[model samples]
Target chain A: MTSSDALAGHTFEELSDYLDRDRTPADPSIEGSPECQTALNGMQRLRSVHRDLLLKDAQRESEREDSWVSSILQHISLEARAGRDIPISHSSPTARLSVTEGAVRGILRAAGDSVPNIIVGRCHLDGDVTEPGAPITVRVDATVLEGEIIASLADQLREALYAALRQHTELAVEAIDITIRDLYQPFVPPAKASSDE
Target chain B: MSDAPSPDPVSTDPGTSSTLPDRLDKVVLAVPGVDELYSAAPLVAAVVKTVIATTVEAVTGEQKSNSSVSVDEKKAGLEIAVKIGVNAPYTAIDVSRRVHDAITDQLEQNGNPDVAEIAVSVARID
Candidate 1:
């Protein structure tokens, strides 16, 4: 498997297929590897957010560009690899504590997703993240649900991300730059809506 | 720092009760924010080890322990490594620290082997 498609030797397609199977008859290889698990978590969350829209989009494939979703998937795959080890300070000389870059990125996405009406896209941690006091800048792209004021939503997302980073990582966050990439309307499964009606 | 021989270095038998790596794995999982334990070794190495272990198990009818924690006995002291997944609402930073402390405390209980290093990394956050 090529590096772009795989995490820890398991391809992203394989991981997605595992999820599609509802993770039944669990694969030890995927379960044993942290990078694969990290990627799976990201893909699972993305699938959950896009479930209805995915169904709709599938039926109308040509109506809109699916590039955004593809971009997010690519980012998730890239970010899930165990990158640098961000050291955690400890008094004891023997204690070598750290949080992985993958884990930090995962939490950053989760924090951004926590803001209602927004789905976090690509997350980038700039600067020397391996260094404890380095000035790190968090740049993230997000898609806001239609109807919410973009400025307010961006502010909310930025704050949520900042708080999560502060709580989970000791990075010297210089700033959080949020880009409003697109707007998506919530898709209510037509079948469900018709049944309700 | 007791100059004791390394206690249960790479306990390969999962059936062996209370192996050092097994005990450490349990302790890490029990930590509040720890969602899952993953192999501290790199992915390719872990896969190869698993394959070899399975073959060994099939041939000898022995259930080899593939514990995620790695423990090494060094001239300096005991070296332990662990990777874990953190549950949301519980930050990875705090969870990793907790795991480190827990491992240290466990080792202390087991004759206080001088710890040269206890490397704990949070691999995922859910």
Candidate 2:
């Protein structure tokens, strides 16, 4: 893609750096661009939870695969754009209300992340999200922390996603399909492991 | 007192008060669920405008108000557009509707006649 297409003309690296700086000196270019702002929001959420997710594995940082993080970052960049305007009906003829597709995806990610032991990797809206009352199926890719029952976690995530979507938009949601792509085990202390064994 | 009555003093100058767009911005942010206000203008246009404004401010020492809310005067009425982020636990759609109603109320209170449309979109839901 050309220069203009990259996260509202700012690279993901630049965004990460900006966040690293705690958004000090307030760069108007990034702040003014909605796409950059959206991505930044996602990045901030991920960063906030990163420590908690890895607290048990602090000593095994090197063993953690960077691929999942890359995958989620890629998805964030793609989904942080204003793709389509899904209308919100208002009784007044003059009032036109709606939510952006990018915003919907943000909620999906948040909902999935809310579930314990699950991190949303990528999200997709499979159907005409722009069309009102269209049959839409939400497909989400996730990575779950090992030791949690996969089936139970998936069910909990599905319910959370459904609730978030129903609350935020008027889309006719047919189903929520969740895929657990990877499972990573947290580092357990030797003493704890021996005691459990 | 003199027999001649003093003419009615002007209560307040509309020009001195905050502009309609500014007022609407405040109103939207004041809504319980709104977390952020994003530029409603398209990305390309917003970038160009920011560049120009930044340059102009640096050279001329004059600050320009870069309001996220877009207002247009039309034959039918005024058209207002805005994009906002809704804080969690507050439904995005509900927040958007509240913002829409808030804008309409602001215009009505200001004695502005008719609203062509008020498009409020939730750009981010935290």
Candidate 3:
């Protein structure tokens, strides 16, 4: 069979074997020669470009400098201005339902998961500590949480906070309190936006 | 104008002190491609500022910072220049692309874009 015919329906390995073993057809022609060379070159170029694109994507992801913190803060401020009391709870000595900056941050970090583009704001937890298993409320100021994802975030934060508090201190892990104070629309700044646009 | 000692300016002046560097550090760290943003001497900052300024002008339609870059014979690699400009965008893609294009173009034009794998990052302003 001709080289092109032989290459047809053959995998790369088969082609490589045919080429490497010098197994040319009985009637040799330029088709057998340059065709193999061209195919091999194409494969190599494809691999190189594939690798470069992957690297470039990763590099682009890493070089990004947008801030989730500011977005979270903005959301929180907006919510506060709207007269909605952002939910928050602490299992400390004082058990109340107000937000604190630190608690807000803790909830956010826990909820962020591996998702990119999510930013958490400073948490404010109000409530009594020293009470184990107290129903601690939770709140978050985030830019991107939708549908069931918000519930998932709440669950994740509850678990994470319980574990973190227990792991770090001897405080009895009480109930988790969750409150989403503000939500922000994800924004990629104008300069970067223009490039992608 | 009545001189009131300027009230010694509240500590929150984004300018004045070393705030820009701190801010840049936060910004740079937030970005993905930036390994780190180091504070350099005045001379180094000047060179970096120039490089950045020239780069932005060449690549982006707008000029954001007055920074530049210079090679440190002693240090071997390029030294970062400073003259913090807060107006510069903090996003990594915006800064990196402009810097990358400028550096690449300059290097290619000068016959060496391949050799200078310089990564430019605008981490902080101070």
Docking quality category of candidate 1 according to DockQ thresholds: medium
**RMSD to truth, every model:** 3.6, 6.1, 25.5
Write model 3 residue lDDT over A5-66, tens digit each, in one string: 43223444554455445556621221222223333433333234334432443355556454
What's the distance in Å from true for residue A19, model 2?
2.1
The sequence of per-residue lDDT tens digits that candidate 2 reaches over residues A76-179 is: 87788878898888888988889989889888888877887888988999999888888999999999888889999999999999999889999999999999
Instruction: Quote model 1's TM-score.
Output: 0.87
Question: What is candidate 3's lDDT per residue for B28-52, written digit by digit as tens?
Answer: 4444433333333333344456567
The iRMS of model 3 comes to: 25.7
- Please provide TM-scores computed only on chain A for all of the candidate models, following their numbering: 0.89, 0.84, 0.33
**The candidate that achieves the highest lDDT relative to the unseen native structure:** 1
Kindly list the per-residue Cα lDDT of model 2 for residues B29-107, writing each as its tens digit: 9998998887788877866777887898999987655667888878887788998888888988789889988887877
lDDT string, candidate 1, A40-145, tens digits = 8788887886777656655676675775666677688778888899888877888888888888888888777677788888888899988889999999999888
- The candidate that wins on TM-score is 1
Question: Cα miss at A137, model 1 (Å)?
Answer: 0.4
Task: For candidate 1, give the lDDT of residue A61.
Answer: 60
After superposition of all CA atoms, the RMSD between model 1 and the true structure is 3.6
Residue A129 Cα positional deviation in candidate 1, in Å, after optimal superposition: 1.1
- Ranking of all predicted structures according to TM-score, beginning with the best and ending with the worst: 1, 2, 3
Highest-DockQ candidate:
1
